[model samples]
Target chain A: MVRFIDGDTRVLVQGITGTQGSFHTRLMLDYGSRVVAGVTPGRGGMVVEGVPVFDTVAGAQDRHEIDASILFIPARFVLDPALEAIDAGLDPVVVITEGVPVRDTMEIVANARLRGTTIIGPNCPGIIKPGEVKMGIMPEQVFRRGNVGIVSRSGTLFYEIASHISRRGLGQSICVGLGGDPVVGLDFIDVLRWFEADDETEAVALIGEIGGDAEERAAGFIAGGGFTKPVAAYIAGRTAVPGKSMGHAGAIVQGDAGTAIGKIEALRDAGVAVGDLPGDVAEALGGLLKG
Target chain B: MKLLEHQAKKIFLDYGIRIPRGELVDSAIKAREVANGLGAVAIKAQLPVGGRGKAGGIQFADSSDDAEMVARGLLGTEIRGVEVKRLLVEEKLDFSDELYLGVVVDRRSRSYMVLASREGGVDIEEVASTTPERIVRHAVDPVFGLRDYHCRRVAGLLGYSGKEMFSLASVIERLYRVAWEMDAELTEINPLALTPEGFVALDARLNIDDNALFRHPDIVEALRLGGSSDLSPREREARDLGLTYVELDGDIGIVGNGAGLTMATLDTVALHGGRPANFLDLGGGASAEMIEAGVSFVMGDSRVKAVFVNILGGITRCDDIARGLVMARSRMGTEKPLVVRLVGTNEEEGRRLLESQGIPTLETMEEAADRVVSFMGGV
Candidate 1:
């Protein structure tokens, strides 16, 4: 019932034997995620940190009941692993690899949507539910079991807010880094929709950066009265260089459309409290929930 | 990853699309020779950025001498911040109508979208804003190839019929294929001129994905040669180290873990009345070597009076960043004031690591920004 993942969710680690995959696999397991198996094409017989390795998601599915799969493959090889997991019926697939080609991501996202699967990120820090499970590469210590549902486009920025929230005794229910790529798996609206239905999530915090119109669309969704949870928003990159992509693929100003001020105004019109800075988010969310 | 016009046209020709016959030359003498060979010619500046025509980077010549003269006038000039080292001498085409055709990555739909517009030789964004209905967009299903019906719908929308419609449809299909095969974020033929012979591409633009450069060796080679000519030396050096760096007009050198955090840091600095010298994202799970490389690059900027290290470690460990700061100081011998803010994932140990080295670490982003701006004596 907790959005996307819970304690009982069995996870399959893609690219399990690789440097990033194996490293985060240990962290996810330590955080109490039910990681059942691992997948590395040529390292089928290998055992990474006591998790059984398979050649493919199909092979991993033979022995364990995997609810979702997390991809840690390199950017160049992300599409194949993602498609393989999707083809094997992995419902909620998470891609953590950065620098995935936009075309390849388009194909993967299109294919995933046609197959009715949820993809989290292509260049994002994954999801973490405190006292339950951690899927991607979020720092576990910053998270504590609480009621705020956190979703963001940036990874480290999410941790900054999460740490601030946790330190102030306002813990998160689930924090999802939807990724910084232009074409991500779950956007602000999608995650917001899930948060609205989850009873455990009392409020939501959306950390959006300058770039695409996803934030503007989220503002529209909130204006439609679809989400009832008190939403606290922070749009980064107010001083971002125009027309230049600030690291992330999705974080760029086209002309006048995807500016921070525009997104902040749109969200404010929808009754969402917007923070002036990253540090102000916790106080903003606290004020919104109290009101 | 925006390709020069000549490079884009080469790809267009490779895909069997007709383009105005052109030759790229650096010298005015060669330009004259080429223009004479082609008869009447147009001298277009070779730059990846837009607005060349409005910026006087394009000119028409009725004779070879005129072409050479125009080329000489433009050869040593800068257009859109790019040096006009090369010019494209192309045969001027006589076209009756101008149309727009492009294949763009539609992020909202999570698909590749092909857009065709009857109105061309103008800003497509203007058309999108003022009259969106003039543009016809068809989201191509990646599973199935670009269907004839899809092309026909776009062609019909552009007001083409019969043989012209079919020809335009084929052009759209080819553009989509080229975009797909080349991993282009945007491949556009603005003002697909309707010459008496057929639809010839008058101007072409192709922006390939930098992340997908592994698949395109030609682009990688081009990038090495001059694809990054727009980037400053510091930015180019950072690129060589596999780091994301954008030079800005500011004094505080800022480096951080993720894009959002990096940008937020920049804003935080600006809020405190201190300008940021550059934008540097060390990325997740960065090593000491990466930190060293990132910090050194930012420090290398002459405009940077101070360095601000902002780390909100998620998968990125702060202790590693501390070691990197230490390593960077040793390697670069920087005397500039360093303000470090470490939080999340081994934050205490990271702070301890910095404190042991006599470097003061701040607790919050606000505190770090305020202290740095104060250290710089305000903007």
Candidate 2:
């Protein structure tokens, strides 16, 4: 009953021979993810941690019914792998590689949209559902089975908050890292729509940072009665100066709209429970649940 | 990574974009020789970001002696945190018209946009915000490439006519090619001047996509030559290890689990009157070794009087981080104070581990920031 991934979702790993890909594939497999096949252009017929490898995504898809794919290719080859996966009919592609060229990412995102395929990140940690299946690079031990649906732009921050919720016995239904790229595939509102429809997800915890009008847009959706789920949110980079570019291409505070103050105020005005600290996320959700 | 004006202009010249004849010099003697070769010259201090003219980084000189004096005064000065190590001495020209030309990847639209204007020598953002009608924008198709007609239309919108129109159009096409070929995120030629002689780029700025560096070996070497190696040693190490680290002007060093948390830590610090010194993301699946390395890296910076470790456990366990912190402290013998906010799996065990070592642990990010700020004598 998890949001994006579950036991039934078959997965393919691109660049499976790479250190990061292989390492996280093992973790995902251990956490019950149905990792069906692996793809590495010249290394066909090899097995990485028991997952069958093929020369191309098309070759792997022929052997397995892949519902989703996780790309571990380097920044330079990110587009090629993603295009290959999408062309092979992978419905949702989760890109974990960072530093992808902005031009290349724009093209890939547009192409994915045209194809009616979902792309998670070109520079982000993947998604996970506690006690079910794990995708991307998040550690598996800290998560626990629960009803809070989590979404965030920062991978590490999402994992930390997931752990906090798990520790407080406030388990999560699913946690999605929408990525930190400026032009990501899915935004806050998109993930909120998914969480709102999921029966297992009783409440939502949204972790946002300074940059873009994503938070503002999400607040608008809530204000417009877009969802009835109790929502708890945390906005980061409050003191970040405007016009200064952060490490993540998407983490810049553009003009006056993307500031933390603006986002926090908007979310508060929308009647969403806003937590002040990472640890307070559980308390905020609890308050929302009570209301 | 931002390049100085001279460096950007050199790349522009390589791409056959017409620019004023110029030579960058580190000393006043070289500046005098270059200025002597060309009668009236412009002495521009080479600094990395924009608004340099308003910062008094550029000056006009009628003679070689005046140019040398200007260069001497600028060479050792600091502008906008960047030291003026060199001066770009170029031939001054009598221009009939000035225009703005730039190519940038618009994230909102997910396309490469070409912007041109009749008004020049001003910030493009200000122009776009204020006089929106004066600027013209065109989105280029990557598959078709930027066509000559596209350039002509942009020039026409800028009120270009005669030889000035044709020459400006040619320059626009060439610059667009450079922007595409070099994988540039932003390429700007402000004051795209048109003189009686010909059209020339008076000022240039090119920001290459860092992801494309592996494909462009030549630009990697060119970047190395600008004496712009300003990143700290720890930051360089972090980059080599495939981590994202940005140094800031603050006293509290932050090492966090995610980019969001790191940024939140920075905000929390500032909200509590404590400045954050840097953003160091250890990424997800942070092992004990990576945590140890991240800790030592932050402690190495003398500007960081205190360190704040913020982690939300997820798959990365609190106990694992606690062990890494202890190991790093023992190995580096860090005397600088540390405040940690650890929550998630094994929280109690992690707290006990740190408490046994007499290390302070805060329950929340706000309290950790407050403790660090208070320890540093209230910011």
Q: What do the candidate models score in CA lDDT, each in turn?
A: 0.89, 0.83
CA lDDT, candidate 1, residue A39: 95
Worst 10 residues of 1 chain B by lDDT: B223-232
Q: Candidate 1 on B265-319: residue-level lDDT in tens?
A: 9989898888898899988889999899899888877888899999888778888
Model 2 chain B weakest lDDT span, ten residues long: B226-235
How would the docking of model 2 be graded? Answer: medium
Tens digits of per-residue lDDT, candidate 2, A1-291, equal: 123677789999999999988988898898899999999999999999999999998888777788999999988889888988777778679998887887778778777766788888877788888888877887777678889999898876676677778778788898888888777778888888898888999999989888878888899999999977888888888766566556567787866657888888999999987777766788888766766
- Model 1 in CAPRI terms: which quality? high
By DockQ, who's the top model here? Answer: 1
Tens-place lDDT digits, model 2, residues B1-379: 6677887887888888888987989999999999999989999987765678999999999999998888888899888888888889999999987889999877556667899988888877788888999999998866466889888888888887777678888998989887888788789999988787787899998878777778788778877876565465666777776667887888888898767878878877887888888888776668888899888888888889989998877657789999999998998785899899997668899999999999978877778888989878644
Q: After superposition, how far is residue A62 of candidate 1 from its true place, in Å?
A: 1.6
Where does candidate 1 stray beyond 4 Å? A1-3, B226-228, B332-334
In the order shown, the candidates' DockQ scores are 0.82, 0.49
